[model samples]
Target: MTPPITYDGRHLLADLYGCPLLGDAALIERALRDAADRAGATIIGLHLHHFGEGHGVTGVALLAESHMSIHTWPEHGYAAIDIFLCGARHDPDAALQSLSDHLAPTRIVRHLIRRGEAP
Candidate 1:
């Protein structure tokens, strides 16, 4: 008998602090794209939402493997991030680590999920 194949998906929930209010949207989006590229995931599209008056932005990057997304509230000193990827050569954990390191969140809550079924 043959064993089923599986892929790893990591979901991260983070509480960020001391993040820059203005111009952080582009920085985060860029970091995500870089991480995706390092993980061997192809970037499809990215959308960023900027709120007025230092509120922050919500950014989402769609990848060929899956997606990486983030929502920020600089005023409250918080951010929520999620990264999901499914493929043979993609490493979702590396992507998650890259984001965490870039953001430098003071408090972090992370979860890992293994997805898909046997062939």
Candidate 2:
């Protein structure tokens, strides 16, 4: 019998649609904090920038395990988010769920990828 292989971490790519507050930088930052907490990921730093009124926001949360990034398209009511964590203790799904709760998007699509495989 062979042992199962495990990678160093997980990477989640998520697309959210029909989001109403895509231009809100403060809200997005708060959501990132909530997401990090839900995933049990330690937050090292955070940054967010809003292009202008009726535009969009870009944000990133630097975590001890890895990072989470979010970019929004207000006109399209869409947001693309990435959550990557490098430890077994973190749950990217939980983080995504938290984001969904805060953003209240009508539709969401996401994918999970295993990261850091040795050749």
Candidate 3:
């Protein structure tokens, strides 16, 4: 059977404020993984980076559908998250919600956009 046509993908960019997530590398990685699962995206690989003491953490989860990345500023109680997934099987919005729930941010600014159209 022929596969259905795939069009643009969903991309969610979020800014989190007053987050309790304080530069924990492992937690960030886990959050990304959980978000990917919530979005129904397949995780291919994960990479995490830890900065100096009291700096922050950065992590990226490479998914079969697309990718999810996060950077935290614990001192500022802020985090930046990007979740992009291709195809209709996955929902970036769900991932965003899951991440937000995990982080428990007091203020959230979210932007959803469509990326890349069908050829």
Candidate 4:
């Protein structure tokens, strides 16, 4: 007998710069949904937060596979994004790529962490 080949997922953390903070929340949310859909993930829920002075954060994207989150610092022109999807057929990379493209960051640092694997 053999152990089942369980599919592990990756958690992506991205540090981005040069992101425009003005009137981009709707666009960002749309892009996130599109990405998740393309990756075969269901968008169960979403939340967006806006700072009083045209700066703030957004998060709470619940996906069937897992979840996606983002925090924005418009004052510093930076944003941090996290995407975690757990499933045998979810493409987290594609979701991240879509976010990067939509944000149009001048510079980006991304880290991928593997989770739920046997040690």
Candidates' lDDT values, in order?
0.73, 0.94, 0.89, 0.79
Kindly report which residue stretches of model 2 are placed more than 4 angstroms away from their true locations once superposed.
1-6
**Which pairs clash inside model 2?**
none
Model 4 misplaced stretches (Cα beyond 4 Å): 1-7
Models 1 onward score TM values of 0.77, 0.92, 0.90, 0.86
Best by TM-score: 2
Model 1: CA > 4 A from native: 1-23, 117-119
Model 3: residues with Cα > 4 Å off, grouped in runs:
1-6
Residue pairs with backbone atoms closer than 3 Å in model 3 (clashes): none
lDDT of 1: 0.73
User: Tens digits of per-residue lDDT for model 3 on 26-103?
Assistant: 778778889999999999999999997888998889999989999999999999999999988899989988888888
**What shift in Å separates residue 78 of candidate 2 from its native position after superposition?**
0.2
Model 4, residue 73: C-alpha shift (Å): 0.8
Tell me the number of clashing residue pairs for each predicted model.
0, 0, 0, 0
Residue 4 accuracy (lDDT) in model 1: 64
The best-first sequence of candidates by TM-score reads 2, 3, 4, 1
All candidates in order of lDDT, best leading: 2, 3, 4, 1
Please give the lDDT score for candidate 2: 0.94
Question: Could you tell me how far off, in angstroms, the CA of residue 35 lies in candidate 3 after the best superposition?
Answer: 0.3
